[model samples]
Target: MGALGKENKDLTGVAIGISVLINVIGTFFFPRLLMVSGKEYGPAIIYGDYKNIWVYILSPILGAVSARILYKFLEVTKPAKPEPWHCNICNHNHLPFF
Candidate 1:
């Protein structure tokens, strides 16, 4: 197994944490995407009050699970090294995301 460096570990952890927060906030926003016509489409689905609770609850659970799964992927992928670059626009070494 490839060992994660401190920066990667910290970055991954922060990403996971942010995902958790987004999922929590999304509980309110996502159900809004549901549309009702006695049919589910077109962004007008009315969430029953109980469904609201269900959504807020399940979303975070799923988010945490997804984060865990993503972490597993992170563990498997090799960390990329920053490439050295010289920029005429500015004098400094820089790396761009590939």
Candidate 2:
């Protein structure tokens, strides 16, 4: 249902933005170095390529888009509403959710 109207876009956009922001913030918490076998060590930031930044920036957007497409295809927004006593929607049917 488009009952949300204009609020839908605003809410969804902010949600996507917030998720991406959290991912970016988490990137900073990544260990700068990796300890191997508790003896040897190496750089944790793999490849050390600035271009890899795009992967971090774009992955959330891509994932969100894919999830939206999947949800629409699965008709999650317009689910089959059964009687309260008979409702039994199983998560197993929706494999790999997000």
Candidate 2 lDDT score relative to the true structure: 0.50
Q: In candidate 1, what are the lDDT values of residues 1-98, reduced to their tens digit?
A: 35776646668767857866765686587655322223332223444334334554465578669867987776645567888898778898778756
lDDT of each: 0.59, 0.50
Please give, for residues 1-98, the per-residue lDDT of candidate 2 as tens digits.
Answer: 44444424556676668766766676588543221212111222454545435544565579769878864664424345543333247523332323
Candidate 1, position 67, lDDT: 64
TM-score of each: 0.37, 0.30
**Cα deviation of 95, candidate 2, in Å:** 37
Cα error, candidate 2, residue 91 (Å): 46
Candidate 1: segments with Cα more than 4 A from true spot: 1-7, 13-49, 76-98
